[model samples]
Target: MAATGTARTAVDSVMAQLSALEDPKMRAVNERHGDDYGVNLSRLRAVAKELKTQHTLSVQLWQSGDTAARLLALLICRPKSFEQDELDAMLRESRSPKVQDWLVNYVVKKSPHAEELRLRWLSDPDPVAASAGWALTSERVSKSPEGVDLSELLDAIEVDMRDAPDRLQWAMNTCLAQIGIAHPEFRNRAIGIGERLEVLKDYPTPPNCTSPYAPIWIAEIVRRQAGE
Candidate 1:
């Protein structure tokens, strides 16, 4: 959608706000993750609050190519109006893992076409699409599992996980943990798969955070949920 003159002015104002709050140190950190923004999340949200017209401004900001602005744009964009081609373009252009995560959670998952995209992208050869597909599946299993085939998911995890790309591996591991925690009937089976895969078994985890190692993470979550 083309931004009107007034909308362009509003976008420019918001960009100015973001630029004023930019932090060089934060920008350096973001650069490590492939994002080119110097602005912090809090500052971006502050700008988002000031610019209430999300849909209009999102279009302009997304076109600006500023990392912070694009993140804000995703927050304000109308999920229902988001098209598949636009989403595909965003995913293709996303180099930062953080941006991809926001796109999956804030935009794609909230869209009306989420399930359709999820099913199609899960098998897509592109790593970005496939990773988003797995991430969406993980979210679905956490909230609702009515139609999802647990058996099929488990089978895929068993067969494809070791050979999956880095991003998809993380999502698959999370999916395994979600299944174990959300469906008690599948807890043992999920645990067995985790044991066999040993995914993230040797990966370091920060203190106070659950290890991404599926078996340990699943067991810890299950224990806590059971009031242990």
Candidate 2:
């Protein structure tokens, strides 16, 4: 009873703090990314720092269904404490790009079920889930290429990337770039596929930032790795 009561108090207190931090202009900017709240990451991190890790409080915040609260929940929660299905449900429930990105990066990556979920998500018809799969695959491509079928990944990217939805397309492009950057064998093929697909070819990249265009992205990262 004491633990439960503490969880409730924590949830209520954090919710109020989150409400006080809301900003209309920030929300307007976040809305472009499908997020509804405006508390910037620095402020959000400060909030998380105070709360520390609290799984029950995180669950309540996630249940509240506010984007900023969900982001905060992700930061303050114990990542590997969640069950596989719970993580899957959270990812699906995450409507905002920020929420989904945070879940995958901060939570799922740390979960014991990561590989199982990664394989399942890769074939999921939902673009967001599929994007998660690709994102995980990119990690594997860079870190553990022993068993991954790099050629098959490239073949799929070649056939599907040009017409993938916005978020999925970006994820697929990242995987393609990762393959080229990590493996010398597939570098030429990945670059050729990116050049042909022209994915993110004309993206409005800010000056001094690496372009997301996969070929350029791949080339630049590789150049830096070689101390060029």
lDDT for every model?
0.85, 0.93
lDDT for model 2 comes to 0.93
lDDT of 2 by residue, 98-201 (tens): 89999999999999999999999997999999999999999999998778999999999999999999999999999999999999889999999999999999
Q: After superposition, how far is residue 121 of candidate 1 from its true place, in Å?
A: 1.1
User: Top lDDT: which candidate number?
Assistant: 2
Q: How far is each candidate from the true structure, as Cα RMSD in Å?
A: 2.1, 1.1
Candidate 1 C-alpha error for residue 177, in Å: 1.0
Candidate 1 lDDT tens digits, 33-87 = 6778788787677767776657867988888877788889888888789888888
Quick one: RMSD of model 1?
2.1
